[model samples]
Target chain A: MARDTAREPVKTGPDYLEVRLGIYRGMVRVRYFEKRAYDLFLQNLVKGTSHLAIGQEAIAAGVAAALRPDDYVFATYRGHAHAMLRGAPMVAVMAELLGRENGLMGGKGGSMHLTYTEGNFMGSYAIVGAHLPIANGAAWSALYRGTDQVAVAFFGDGATNIGAFHEALNLAATWKLPVVFVCENNLYMEYTPIRKVTAVERPAADRASAYGLPPVLVDGNDADMVFETATRAVGLARGGGGPSLIEAVTYRHGGHSRADPGKYRPDAEVAEWLAKDPIPRYKERLLDEGVAAEVLERIEAEAAAEVDQATEQAKAAAPAHPGGLEREVFSDGGATWRR
Target chain B: MTYREAVAAGLAQEMARDPSVVLIGEDVGAAGGVFKATAGLLEKFGARRVKDTPISEQAIIGAAMGAAMTGLRPVAELMFADFVSVCHDLVANQVAKARYMTNGQVSLPLVVRFGNGGGLRFGAQHSQSVESWLMAVPGLKVVVPSTPADVVGLLAAAVRDDDPVMFLEEKALYPTSGEVPEGEHVDELGTARVRRPGKDCSVIALGTMADRALAAAEQLQAEGIDCEVIDLRSLVPLDMTTVAASVAKTGRVFTVEENPRLCGWGAEVASIICEECFYDLDAPVRRITTPHVPLPAADSLEDAAIPSAERVAAAIREGLG
Candidate 1:
């Protein structure tokens, strides 16, 4: 089993307190946005399918807080939280889910492929384990250009068994590229439990030694611990200490997608994870740390209001125009294959 | 210059001109290349630019896509065209659709070069023409160079272009010598070159089949049959204008293909010819391709499987009749 570093006591200081509040606010924003997305999906406002990160907010929030503004982030389909935390406009993200012309990708990407280049959130890949090597490529470019920028790739625990994951890790370790691979071990891969399919108990961390990387596992539910682990990993990568694989053990609150009710999971397991929900746990932590209840309430209210505004704005936007179908396929701004 | 030497020269020319161009693949550094096509590049460019990666095609192509997304213009090589299946997701799904999916948020200015086609009896796994596989995919520029000159010029063009290009080098033609243009040689991507012009029939081919078509055209000329040989340098940016014009003049068309008969690149060309040049064509657009089966290891069987000069001439002559 990977070492549990979630038991470390929270540090106390004015600066630390401020950072903690920011992390908490980020988590709240994600929780509200995801819940709104769920509602939107139910109303048929969200097209296709959406993977919600309702219970897995801390990994995205903590990792985003640890990264620099210019740092690149490559995320998977379940990436609303990652994109929002990296400063992607909430309205644009909502519009993308709604498949609107004013969406992040002009409705071309939809929910699974949200990309805000301005925020350095490179892209959200739909294919499993596809973006890991691409993340290495971004890190390689930074190294080649003599920039201190690092690339971070977010994937699920299921990605550990895929060939691209192993291939990416080996290549990153070999080249010593400035990249951080974070695995949000949300207990399940789609509908099935990851442990039932995987050979090892700790899917990602156990494979670290094969690539000459140290096994670093942390509690995905604790924003403070994830932030600290991410900060160290990001600093090491930026300083040319090579790639780091961090297995963040967490659980998903709902099913895999809008379609799944996730009834395959035992009711007891679901109840247990719901009780340890990161948002309420962190709020309790803040209250216990001598922080005012009004501040926490204000953050929650602000997050809810932001989600509400974004929802309205997305609903008002028009569907993508059919005339622009052949545009932007090439750098020439045309999809013509023949002369 | 030999076709193989032109590969290195084209890479060197681009690397010298553009500081952003970097080469990465398995055994591409100190070991030169498996086919020596990338010889002397490591010595000239140094380790920072010329990198040797592990045997991971997914990582190689993925890294190339990632680097291209950021800033660097990466030229990645998969040892064999057949190996594209190993990293098909990166090629077909990720790299191909990324630009369009992101609504042009990212531009993939990269090249994936691979040894393609069968002649040396490498059998099913190592010997396969994959141009047809990529032709079906969108957002990819497919370049198949027959001669050394086209290899050098087209490669330079592919590197400079701000889109993902699949540079398929016919491995059999690597030893064949041809005159390459000196200093900065860049050819247009979508244009087809008419190697031999005629009035009786239009013989269209790609990569290795282009040379065979030219040979077939020469053979048919002595028998009172004038064949127009059109070499399709780039498949994606297909020069249908040139093809349509040739078909109008000749009134007869035949496609020489190395890929299997089923869903080959020739099928697309045939469909286009029938659609646009149906009235101009005197006969049906005949596609003389390899049989729909895995390439055999035996010399005679492999030779029989792939379309030859005789087969192309016979098909055109029979069609013209």
Candidate 2:
């Protein structure tokens, strides 16, 4: 019950509010960065497709909190949060979205292919459910190497129906691979509502039982809830509990990408979810539980400055040298080279 | 040693030498592989080293990538070259792109061994020389050895390399015998070897066609029309220097392959020779290859579809003319 309490816990005393502020700061960082990224896209500062993780900051902040620095994280196109949470330099990610050379993937991958090997973030894929099998492959390596590392694969509700989703889950279950298949079910797959696609009432979590794997549903809007649930799941995985699927019921506040303004969703539906905005809900919970007003403001001011600095640095980052395109296509040991 | 035994020897010696090297494929373990090239590997290295996997080519390749990325060397067999389409994304995209996409931070020390090309009555699905398709994809090192020694040597080299190598063993060459080294050996990927030396003309051949070229060389020697034969040990990093040098000396060229002529590996070879050795040529470059059509299912029709030693000799004669 204490672990599930709304009040933020501290190691030393009630004044040790820095820990709680850090979580809020991370969520705010992601939130503001995504919001600015969308604005930049409108003005053509960012190029190509951009999957804004606007309302899903809590999911990333919470899930990342449950992971060790060396644990693996694989994500889909809606992956800005996952990249940020996995310890990728915010400037590099932001610059990458802007097609800068200093970006994580050297401006080659644009937004969908962010990679941070040092952070153990394998990579993000644009193809629906394409990285699921790749995540399983990484998990299998972890198991093979006898490391206690666990791999977390993040995908959207639409990916649940892909062949790779079922095959990868089955293989992971069979091998008892230490993996967490996190389905960030935002209730809509692009424009099609999940309810229309499947007769199941609950979520993708309900189908996990079919694979003989445990599944859980949580309030993806609440950072604390997402963190606590993810902690349990990750702990179970590290303890050799085998594979499990966690369905986080969040909502994407922005369009699927910059191209679409989500015209299909009814105005009432947007109003309903916006009323329960994740950041405000968590902020309210923090304040109600007696988080000092000054501490909260300082957190916001610091996060805003950090996001602004990242954006400026991203804008200033140079484009990758033209010659870099010809390099890294193959090993130099006389392999095939496509001219 | 037989071609099959030479390949088996390469796997045996490599697995015996490196504890981290493993052979994972559809029937590579207890079944000694579908072509029996892995015969006795399971008994020698045990199941851990010689692993048999499910029919999932994706899993086979993905597992190989996993193992290769994590310091283990994996030799994955696709059973037959025709099924490479099933794992095309894995081989062409994942394995090939791993090194580059990771910015050379990682090397896929993975070898894909499969019996390629249709000369036998293996039918359409089972018989195909898809080497050109793979050759079209960058970041993949393709080695199609023509003899027992080359098979053993190139495979050993592929296993030791840090790049992803496609070791294409022709289905028809499994029983073809030639002298292989008694011990371990490694061969370079891009270097071509002249199996037979002459001066009348140069015949560039690959895979099974190399053997046919060598046989044609012997036949041409008897008729006083000496022909030089260059075996292209690898397709991707093709030994263009040897080809050019030989073509420059002879002033004539003939490219041979089992794949269809249109956009075939032969076309690539011919283009390279023409670009590099056109001044040295006394006649236009000629190609002795299968017509641009899917291989026929019947044995006689299939034989007609692929280039033979006689066809290659005739092409050389025409180049000389």
Candidate 3:
């Protein structure tokens, strides 16, 4: 099947350069945060399991850079990057991962369920394909309330086969809802290559025609390309053009999770993707475009320092109190079910 | 008013009062639902609010959760209670845990209503009493209304409340008629109502079984066994205070359950009663429940599987003796 590359022309002006720099900075911040989380996991500071987006930072950064502050974003469990890019405090996200009191959800929700409603980063759903319909619902609410606030759902290539995926796309199309379905096609779903299990070659884009949506395919490693695609998609949605399906082609730099060594893929394939890593490649492009090296270095240094401070704060914070276990089960501020 | 009409009435009252309240389901709009309980809702609320979704339970429930999370108060109807299994993830993992897992940052003020239980003989797949399934889930408030008045009143309360409520309308009782209070009528959740007050024994039941328990109490009254029938309107908030109070007064208790015996709502009630009213009991807490088996399609087999009025009365008499 033919894949449609993002057609929004990249402007070459100071303003556009600033936007590119901002996207690059966003990606750098996410990259630093994820690396710090990986180190914390190794040191046993982060409990349970955490899904990292080490190589997939460009998609979150670019898509989020294109969205307005009030627009909703629903991401999958591998969502540290998405949360940070949407302006969730770095300290809170780090603390949440460490199960500390100052965590995003006061340590109630751990790594997989990061939610910062104040930032409009709706949630990071662990269940695959479940949030697609939910994103549609938020978009429906926006449409109902006469707001231009479009909703965006971010998932991996694996979610395309699930029943909720098809149901949500069709419903969004039928209702003409303002939402964008961004599939970070990371080539693999968990341990297996998505191609082996999925029927189609392009997991998300190939299935777009069935829902009457144009198949959108973008090079996920290129922040500029992702930004342009997302800008058009978000604009179209806000303009009442209904939903868009964009399959961002990328690869995870590490294993599916912390436990796996990612030995399933051929060494040659891993090296190929590593060579095309989005961060270094984008930084080199910015340098070639006559941007000062100090500008890029400053961004990287700031991001690293911010992540370091967050790590220290999270490590020093106390664990969530046990007495609050029976709270927030209902809206009444208590878990009481009886008189 | 009939229980079926009250379904529409309760929805109309809430939708009229709150603009955020919307209805979505399969055939819930122009078709008036498969059970015709939602008739005239589309004409009254218009297509914008009264949405007839495709035959997709996941989408229906997922959309409802999303809407509730944001601003809208959505009421989603699944044609049959058994269909909840198809979209159980949305209810159990997503909607039920969203508010808790998010630390109350997201509150899902939504309601999912379904036609529950066996009497229509729709076979194993269609005729299931699934309040027990939902009540086991922590974040959900499970409501099973026994009469038309309770249907209208409880539904109003469920819609108004800021939580996810699983509203189970007994399929067999949809045609049953009773007087409903005029105008805006709302009842509190987590409260039990005593249909018949007596001192000999307390008979506890849910949904359709409440009527059956009342009938059995009438039969036991004739036999000089004055029974108190308590209808548990909501299962999540088990209303153990009322149940324990009744058990204390009667000194003997019997639970008439339509669900399979194992881990039914009655089991929870029985355990609580034993714990709270251990000294007040004159007899062992007898549970009059259906044998643990799948409901058959045949009328007689279905009738035998679910505790009938005769079966309940006979169990009460045997236990008392």
- Candidate 1 CAPRI classification by DockQ: high
Which one wins by DockQ: 2 or 3?
3
Runs of candidate 2 exceeding 4 Å displacement: A1-23, A194-206, A333-339
Candidate achieving higher lDDT, 2 or 3: 3
Candidate 3, Cα interface RMSD: 0.8
Relative to the true structure, candidate 2 reaches a TM of 0.91
lDDT of 1 by residue, A1-339 (tens): 112322232366787788888999999999999999999888888879999999999999888888889999999999998888888999999999998888988999988998988898999999999999999999999999998899999999999999999999999999999899999999999988999999999999999999999999999999988998998888888877889999999999999999999999999999999998998999998899889999999999999999999999888989988877999898999899997
Number of clashes recorded per candidate: 0, 0, 0
Candidate fnat values, all: 0.88, 0.26, 0.78
Which structure among the candidates has the greatest DockQ?
1
DockQ of 1: 0.89
lDDT of 3 by residue, A1-339 (tens): 012322343587787898899999999999899999999999999989999998998899889878899999999999999988888999999999999999999888999999989988899999999999999999999999998899999999989989999999999999989999999999998998999999989999999999999899999999989998998898888887889999999999999988988999999999999999999999999999999999999999999999999999999999988877989999998898876
What overall lDDT goes with each candidate model?
A: 0.93, 0.81, 0.92
Arrange candidates by DockQ, descending.
1, 3, 2
Instruction: In model 3, state the lDDT of residue A90.
Output: 97
